[model samples]
Each structure stands twice: as C-alpha cells, then as structure tokens.
Target: MEILIPLTASLVLLLIGYFIGTILEKKHYQSINDREEKFINLPSVTMTYRAASKETDMSKYSKTQLVSGGVVVSIDYFKRFLALLRNFFGGRVSSYETLVDRARREAILRMKEQSSGADMIINVRLETSTISSSAGDSETVDSIEAFAYGTALYK
Candidate 1:
C-alpha cells in the first residue's frame, strides 16, 4: 500500500504536468503564428550578404543600419522530464525541438519588428545558446537564448 501511494502520486503529478505543458506550448505557438502574420509584410529578410545580381540596386536605399532581436525561452516541467528520459536512450531530444524552433522564430519576428522602417534586411544571422539552472546539486539546461541580427536598408 505504501509503495502504491507514492507511485500513484508520481503518476498523477506527471499527468498534470503533461497536460498543462501541452496547453501552454500550443498557446505559445498560436501567439507566435499570429505575430508572424502581423509582421509578414514588414521587410524582406535574407541570409545572403547581397541580393541577386540582377536585383541589386544600391541607389534605392539612402541609409543602412544594424538591427537585432533576442529572446529567451524555457521548457516546461513536462518537457524537461521527457528530455531526461531521452538522454538515457542516446537519441535526438525531440522535446527540445519545439522550444528551439519557437525561440528562433520569435527572435526573427522581433528583429523584423525592430526594423519596421527599413525596406529590407540583409546579411541575417542567428545564434542560439543554452541557459543552465542549478537543480539542487547539479546544473541542467533550463532554457535557450536566441539572437537574430541583420543589416537594414532604408529608402
């Protein structure tokens, strides 16, 4: 009876965490999609340093400046728990994929928002880093930081 009590308690907690995490993740993704759509027409973003040869027209822009955006995202308890189990299997950590994708997209949207006055953003770059947190005696990756930067040209 004693063993069953602890096991049941653990299972209940895990179930609660999973449901809450799923809801929060879906909500965040919905918000991201809405914001992305809002900024879809802001400016053209590209990783290439220069536009295609035929499209290059330096005379169109009168000013250029650097624009950047950064975001920090953390995984919920359910995702962290899933990741811990995946670590033992030595396979891709699928739980972290959505977290990383969200951070990256949010960063890019913020960069575009910051450069709303620009005609286009070129030479775009993205960077990501893991943030660690102390859990009792050990440190674990608790969140991720994403940064996006680019050069904005204004007409």
Candidate 2:
C-alpha cells in the first residue's frame, strides 16, 4: 500500500506535467509563427560579412550596431521520463528535439525584434547551451538555451 501511494502520486504529477507542457509549447510555437511573419521581410544572413553586403556598397550603411537575443527552454518531467526510457532503449528522443528547435527559433525572433528599425542584419550566428543537474555520477538535462547575434545596419 505504501509503494502504491507513491506510485499513484508520481503518475498524477507526470500527467499534469505532460498536459501543461503541451499547452504551453503549442502557445509558444504559435507566438513564434506570428513573430516570424512580422519580420519576414528583414534579411538576416548567417554567412560572412562580405556575402551579406556584397551587392550593396558600404557607404549606403550610415550606422552599425550589434544585436543579440537569447532564450532558455526547460523540459517537463514527463519528457524527462521519456528521455530516460529512450536512453535505455537506444533510440531517437524527438520529444527533446522540439525543445531545442523552439529555443533556436525564439532566439532568432528576439534578435530580429531588436533590429526592427535596421535595414538588415549581417553575419548572424547562433550558439546553444545545455544545463544539467548532476547528482554524483548521474546527469540529467534540465534546460537548453539558444543565443543569436548579428550586426544591424541603418541608413
């Protein structure tokens, strides 16, 4: 009976986490899509500086400023449990993949938002970070972060 009580509690927590996490993730993706549409016209190049402004002359750019954006995304307990199972079975954990994707897109949107007035963004770059909780020899992923940066030019 004692073990049954703890097991039932854990199952309840897992269900709550799964439902809430799904709702929040969907909402976040919707917001990302909306913002992406708003900034679709702004050009952000990930290549070198020359490639970005190759056609346009440097004189056309009157000012240059560095812009950056970062976002952190945490996983739900249910997803964590899924990941553990996948680790044991040795297969893809696509549930975790969405978290990283969301963070990357959100970071880019934030960078673009910062440069809304600029003509273009050049030399864009993205960096990712992973946070984990390590207790003794066991390590579990807690969250992930994505950061985007670029140079914005204004005429």
Candidate 3:
C-alpha cells in the first residue's frame, strides 16, 4: 500500500506535467502558424526569371522558371526536449513530427501563395535547423528552422 501511494503520486504528477506542456506547446504552435501565414500572404515582385537547367534545346516544351524567395523561420515552441525525452518511455514523439510536418507544408503553401501564375513546382527541398544545436540531444536546447524551395515552371 505504501509503495502504491508513491507510485500513484508520481503518475499523477507526470500526467499533470504532460497536460500543461501540451497546452503551452499548442499555443506556441498557433503563434508560429500565424506568423507564417502573414509571410505567405506578403507580396512578391519579380524582376527577372531564370532557370537553373539549360536544357532548352533538348526539351520540346517551353518552360518558365518561377523561384520563390526562401524564408527561414525559427521554431518558437518551448519544452520540446522534455517532450522528446518523455516520448522514449511513452508511445512516440508525436509533437516533433507534427511540428516538422507543419513547417514543411506551410513553407510550400506560402511559397505558392506568394508566387502567382506558376503552373507547377518541382524538386522541392527542405532544410532543418536549430537555433543553438545542429542536432537534437538529450541535454541540448531544442530549436528548429525549416528552409523550403522548389523550381516553379510555367507551361
């Protein structure tokens, strides 16, 4: 009975911590999304258009390359390391995957929104980064940034 009481207390505390962390992290995610939306809606004026590939003579179709200005956004959420640690014992680190996916999608959607009159975008690339650490570690501060780019073409 005595051991059970302590174990129960530990479990309760763990649950409470998780709940609080989730709430805070959600709020942070919302904030990041808001900022990204604004960036996507911002106007982009094109001065010159160029293609990276020079296969003009080889290809039969005429292609106009549309390049979107790349923007890098730092991850705004806190307590991510704690969440990752907790994930090892729990099911999985859902939050990390969710955040990464969100950033990639938002970057692409925003680029499309900013660049108008493009038929298709090909060869999309995503780059990941953190504020302080290059890689995520147990005792390291958790921060993430995503860089997304693609070649937009007009047919």
Candidate 4:
C-alpha cells in the first residue's frame, strides 16, 4: 500500500536519527567530563557573594575580574518527539533535562578554563535561554543557550 511505504520510510528515518543522536550525546558527555577533570584544581568556584571570613584575606588578592562562558546546544529529532508527547500528557519532559544539564555544565567548564590562573571564582551565576528556528512555516525551539559568569580573584 502507499501508506505502508511512507510509514516505513518515516520509521526508518526516526530510527537513524535516534541512533546518531544518542552517539553524539554520549561523545559530548565524555568531552565534558574530560574537560572538567582538567580544571579540577584550577580554582575554587562558588555561588556565594562573599568569601568566608576564615578562608582568605581579600585585601591580599589585589585584583578581581569578571569571567563568563556560554554554550548553545541543539535538541535532536528523537528528543523533540519525546518532548512533544510529554507535552500532551502533561508530565515532566525528562528528555530535555540532559540537554539543559549538559549545556550548564559545559558553560561552567568553559568559564573555569577562561580563569585558569585565578585563585577563586565567586558569585557564580547561570542563565539559560531557548533559541527558535523557523522550519517550513512555523518556528520551533531548536536549541538552548546556557551562560555562566563569576568574579575571578588574582593574587
């Protein structure tokens, strides 16, 4: 039947997309982990506005600067399909969770990389936004941007 051919083709395309997406996701995660490890000893990063009294004497540092990092990540077709289904059912869209998480982590890692010589990073902040792309006649959320920023102190 005509329907059978189109249906089969759609399913095959979906399967291919899913497999390729999964592989790319795994590779990205691995890269993130490796970068994180490389920066593990660079500096202490924190979200608190002020350093603890006992930690250090701020007057000694003599310099402070702002540092930031940002990353944009796109959602794969498979994840978009799952998210659409979840929207109709009114449940948690777990499929997008990893995408957001990865973006956040990557942004922070990049920030750390930028301030490799700093003694510490304080008042860390993160921001996220969705990017839309036009497909055919409609616009859809195609990617997310995560930004991380903080103050870096130097001796």
The residue ranges of model 4 lying beyond 4 angstroms of the native Cα positions read 47-49, 52-54, 134-139
Which residue segments of model 3 deviate by more than 4 Å?
1-63, 69-81, 87-91, 133-141
Cα deviation at 146, candidate 1, in Å, is 0.6
Model 1, runs deviating above 4 Å = 1-9, 47-54, 134-136, 139-141
TM-score attained by model 1? 0.85
The residue-by-residue lDDT of candidate 4 on 58-78, one tens digit each, is 787878889999999997887
TM-score to native of every candidate shown: 0.85, 0.92, 0.48, 0.88
Candidate 2 stretches with Cα past 4 Å from truth are: 135-141
lDDT by residue (tens digit), candidate 2, 42-152:
988876667766778878889999999999999898998888889899888988999999999999999999987998898899999997767644646579989999999
Per-candidate Cα lDDT values, in order, are 0.85, 0.90, 0.56, 0.85
lDDT tens digits by residue: candidate 1, 1-155: 78899888878877887898889889989989999898777665565655532477778789988999999999877788899999898799999999999999999988988997887888888999988866654647589999999898888
Pairs of residues at least 3 apart in sequence or in different chains that clash in candidate 2: none
| Alpha carbon deviation, residue 121, candidate 3 (Å) | 1.0
Measured by TM-score, the strongest candidate is 2
Q: In model 1, which range of ten residues has the least summed lDDT?
A: 45-54
- Evaluate residue 14 in candidate 4 and report its C-alpha lDDT on the 0 to 100 scale: 76
Higher-scoring candidate on lDDT, 2 or 4: 2
Worst 10 residues of 2 by lDDT: 132-141
